[model samples]
Target: MNRTFKVALAAGAATVALAACTNSSTDGTPTPATNGVASQTKSSSTTSGKPSNGDDLNISRFADKPCDLIKPDQLTALGNFRPGESSSAPLGPGCSWFGVDALKDTTFFVTLVTKGDNLESMAENAKSFPIFKRTTIAGREAYSADRTDGKASCSTAVSTSAKDAIFVQGRPPANGTGTADKSCQASEKVAAIVIGNLKG
Candidate 1:
């Protein structure tokens, strides 16, 4: 079931040269690799907050190394995992992290929105998702959304600036279990970790 979901996502990734992402490898649990980007360590400030909406982080650099967004300690704390498994969608370059027990643990993603789709635009497409409502992570404004009810996959899209944003998505184990709240929580956790790594 998990492999099927990732394949579907990866299929979209192949539509364009830039869209290189999905959640995991379709073959099986992969040997953790970062596609040549340097390995990342967690920052001390994974907490969230922004004094003003204009105060956004410059996240464009991570497009080439999306896996660096995840703090190593925080990621490993979830389970024996590393953020890599690169693939992409029209949204942007993405790196995925799947728990060692792929079928039983959670799946995570961090995608840099290189395109023009930011939080404001996401609101325009709110009707497309069952849960596209406002929220905050790491002190920045965002929206938590899912096509379904987040029973499996959920994401938090954070506005980094007027021009770009970052998307952090999480999925429960492929066993077809997990509630909407739990899935969204996973997304929120990953988003905070990414925001903490951003400078400027």
Candidate 2:
């Protein structure tokens, strides 16, 4: 397969893997099993009585400057970091920021997927998430997934519109001592910042 196809496939597979980790009951609602494991519910098309259309935001504005989605100050708040790197992908534009010093080896990835085909693929993959939950960030419908194996990684998907979404994935520094929850929390923090900026 070609490089572009491979990247698209890899992105799709990541989404599917996240969906597969969701621990839900047959009815699609989140439930804690008898074993005491709690599952996050799959969100519907609407959230907080609001539609997931993301009409108030424009994702295209950031398509060419995904790296600028988060400001330098925000990166400093997240942790010591190097400059961001940019790339293009089938999904849209992508950016990555790495941690510095003690966190020098860790990185956070953000991407915008605007094509209808890509979003549809992600929507299908979202179904397999064992811990997908609806959330509101900057008054937009958002979903998040946690690593099932207790790793320091988190993924968040924000619905920019019916056919577009922003994907944020974060991993703790390879040599850092942060916990999985901390890593996910960091991901959420970054997602919140990104959504806030997009709303501007």
Candidate 3:
């Protein structure tokens, strides 16, 4: 299997572990009303002052359509990139865009995982990187890390809810010329776009 695939599988496993350990329920089983009345059905709509736990809008909804998260105009603005393949794996669903330039080429991917609380998971994983930085994207907390592979790779984890997040990873194009920071910036930009779509 591909190294990327293996990494994704590992992520998926971690996600499952975290989710199983977290309390995702907002309320327990409904109770009967007085006077032998039935309890009112609770609305699924998000309530004000309540933090999202990803229960209202789960990542599984996009498990098979990750490519739809990005718009065509957004892709054009990013780099006139060609649409790459989409995949559904243990880590969730993801899509990649490929861009080629005279001097550098780039590949950017976006993935969503619903099984875990990425905010906490990123905290632990960031310790392994020398360039991990906390930031915000789309008004949500996020973490950016420079991959050990040097300037060729970058990744960002943006929290979608208390229990889920979307991960964006980018790599310099084959034989391409670009710095690690540039790759990371590109990944962040793509992540913001994807998050914007999700929020809307």
Candidate 1's error at 81, in angstroms? 2.5
lDDT of 1 by residue, 15-78 (tens): 3223222214454221111211111111112112223366768887777778777767877776
- Candidate 2 lDDT over 1-200, as tens digits, reads 23463355346434433333354557554332221112223335222233454375687988888899999888877776668877675456778775554234455778776544232334344445455556765666676665353255666767676656677777666556766566667767788898888877
Q: Candidate 3 — what's its lDDT?
A: 0.59
For residues 1-200, write the lDDT of model 3, one tens digit per residue.
Answer: 23564366345434433332333346632222221111112223211213664543356667778888888887877775666558653335677665544135566767775543355454453445655778898777887775354476677777777656787777666567777677778788888998888866
Return whichever of 1 and 3 wins on lDDT.
1
Using lDDT, give the best candidate's number: 1
User: TM-scores across all candidates?
Assistant: 0.71, 0.66, 0.67
RMSD in order of candidates: 11.4, 8.3, 12.5
State in Å the error of residue 156, model 3: 0.6
Q: Which segments of model 2 are wrong by more than 4 Å?
A: 1-54, 101-106, 117-123, 146-150, 177-180
Against the unseen true structure, what C-alpha lDDT does each candidate score? 0.62, 0.59, 0.59
